[model samples]
Target: MLEYVKTILQKVSFNAYLFERELKKGMRYLMPTELEEFKDWCYATFGMSHQPILNRYFRPAY
Candidate 1:
């Protein structure tokens, strides 16, 4: 599951909206430990958790 998320994460940067959707799906499917590791990976990769960042960038602009 983590590997699947990693693979999607790699491609998601190409489209913020897609990233947002996929991320939500990931949250649904990932276990607690997997979510933690995913969070860690997000911090390591982008210097913060991916959730709020993706929301800010990908959500409908007001």
Candidate 2:
């Protein structure tokens, strides 16, 4: 699921709205244990282009 999401995210990276939508959708299907790893990969891969979107979704709960 994580790899599949990564692939989708990469494919949709051209559109911020689509990327964010897919990111949200992808997060839904990930296991709690996979979230940390997924978050790390998202930042590493999309940080330059979509830090705001990633940050919004990956923010720590207060």
Candidate 3:
């Protein structure tokens, strides 16, 4: 899963919203700890703008 995320990041450099969409779409497979780790890595790698968008998908009902 981590490798998949890295592949997406490398391919897009965050140029495509598709990367975010894919992450959300692919999230069902992640464990809670993996999700939190991914969230942290994503924010650190992509910056805080990722927080709200990713969180929206992370907890869509909230």
Candidate 4:
């Protein structure tokens, strides 16, 4: 799961620090539209529940 996130970040040239900061800020959960699309993509590609991994990577803004 972490590996998948790392690969995506690497592909996008996202810095580790920046990625961690964004995740800490709850960027993924805050952006429901994008999150939904990402979930769909993960489901189609990996055939697994993305919520578990997503919860690990991104916390709710609240």
Top lDDT hit: 2
TM-score of each: 0.67, 0.94, 0.60, 0.32
Q: In terms of TM-score, how similar is model 3 to the real structure?
A: 0.60
lDDT of candidate model 3 versus the reference: 0.66
lDDT of 3 at 54: 58
Tens-digit lDDT string for candidate 4 (1-62): 43455456435333445544543444343355566555445446433423444456545569
Model 3, position 40: C-alpha lDDT score: 66
lDDT of 1 by residue, 1-62 (tens): 88888788778856666767777787788887776677667657754535566545334438
* lDDT (Cα atoms) of all candidates against the true structure: 0.68, 0.95, 0.66, 0.47
Instruction: Please state every model's RMSD to the true fold in angstroms.
Output: 6.4, 1.2, 3.3, 8.3
Runs in model 3 lying further than 4 Å from the true structure = 48-52, 58-62
lDDT of 2 by residue, 1-62 (tens): 99999999999999999999999999999999999999999999999999989889988779
Q: How would the candidate models be sorted by lDDT, starting from the highest?
A: 2, 1, 3, 4
Give the clash count for each candidate: 0, 0, 0, 0
Alpha-carbon deviation at 5 in model 3, angstroms: 2.3
Of 1 and 2, which scores higher on lDDT?
Answer: 2
Cα lDDT tens digits, model 3, 2-53, are: 7686567657656548766677665766777787777667668766546666
TM-score for model 1? Answer: 0.67
Query: How well does candidate 3 score on lDDT at residue 4?
Result: 82
Reference-based TM-score, model 2 = 0.94
